[model samples]
Target: MSASGAKTNLHEFVVQENEQVAEGLWRMRCNTALAAELAPGQFVQVSVPADASHILRIPLSFARADARSGELDIVYAVVGEGTRRLSAMAVGQASTMVGPCGNGWWLPQDQGRALLVAGGVGLPPIFACASMLAQTGVGFDVVVGAQTASRHCVGYVDELRSMGIHEGCDCARKVVLTTDDGTLGMRGFVTQAMENLLAEHTYAQVYACGPNPMMAGVAKLSMSKDIACEVSLERMMGCGFGACSCCNVALVDGTQALCCTDGPVFDARRVQWQTR
Candidate 1:
């Protein structure tokens, strides 16, 4: 996931669309040339003007990016003031965005079958990766989870739609959804869904993003099976660039790694699960 594309810097972007897909969850689209420069698994640090009290920019993954339209889609769950401010943005409002940052997922050359595990708001980068994989005819399956069935509506449906994935879509059967309360496709977490898939399919690789606990399980599972795996890490980041040490994460080597630079994505085997 080496940084690629145009120079990364602050860019003025106007909100093209903003809509709430579910409780406290929003899907925001903004017009910016930088969208064309973004690679799958990368993130943008956004400054919500309404949050004058918070100086740190909120990091968000690219749910979808249309280089031709110069529109970047950001799917997020509002957990605090910064994100609440971000969700309030009205169409045409402007903000400062810096990104296309962080080392992203390692795409395999084989392009064989792969598994994608997503949980809660971690769907963006994984969704972006799916889009690219589908375009290249890489056979893949997805296991996504949320707290409840309703929580599953938070841009997951729309995100899949935007990617041309639907009930009747070619990859429809490959996508599985799960929830904690039996309110969705399956009544369990994504890990259970992944376990079922692994039993029936032989995947060449695994890609995952989500809460640390969930990712830890996926990483552990992948490692147990000796399957190559990559994980996108989530951390509180202030600056989009490496200058800010706020997003540092512990590594397997007993060293600190910056999620904003070294990676928001890393080989699953390289992460130190205990430290998380």
Candidate 2:
């Protein structure tokens, strides 16, 4: 079930624009009603057209959703056959998608600035989270990372910077870009930038989406500081809903939860990072 208490449904979507945004990364805009229903951190299961034999849908999270425009932007990496096929889809092509799946990021319980960390394609949800914060008059700082300069999305960074200028927002926002190969702003992991920020300033909450190891590191740092943190986890889902049970997330409580339904977003402390 979605946060709005509605059962997931198949929605028809038309591709508006599908083009390469960064090396090996493609940004796609789709016209669909699902845009209004989606919350930050939630994902959609899209059935790639022209592949009746391939039953599995590609699960993707959106970078932006404009309810008025009835459009959503998805930033995806061309990793395998499914995504490669998705990249080939032409503008005006129509397809079916199941959404708005899973829970989304929750606002911080206490009032203070928050920190956002994103790596690679993880930038989408993190960008969405920043938008949510901006709309609610919450202040935030961002750290975006990629393997190298070519893999980074400068457009999202610019969008994040613009959030600092929101009408009611009074606090200054800091946006940091990091690349492992030292080809960009900072040379090192997002964690390294996060560490420096944590040391210099205090934050009420932290939000992150990235590879397991990177998120684990973020969770550890947040826990040590006694700060609340939320992380969006990625899993392979045969069924985007709960039926297949392929996307199990091990919790610290010795139980397993389905990532597709229970969460793609979860409390950082509750997850068993070792299992990931």
Which sections of candidate 1 miss by over 4 Å?
158-173
Candidate 2 lDDT over residue span 1-276, tens digit each = 697465689999999999999999999999999888888989999999897889999999999999899999999999999999999999999999999999999999887999999999999999999999988878899999999999988888888999748466477889999999999999999999999999999999999999999999999999999999999999999998899999999999999999999999999999999834
Best by lDDT: 2
Can you write out model 1's per-residue Cα lDDT over 183-241, one digit (the tens) per residue? 87899889999999999988899999999999999999999998999999988777768
TM-score for candidate 1, please give it. Answer: 0.92
**CA RMSD per model (angstroms):** 2.6, 1.3
Q: What value of lDDT does candidate 2 attain over all alpha carbons?
A: 0.93
lDDT of 1 at 259: 88
Give Cα-based local distance difference scores for all models: 0.83, 0.93
Off by over 4 Å in 2: 164-169
Query: Residue 114: error of model 2 in Å?
Result: 0.2
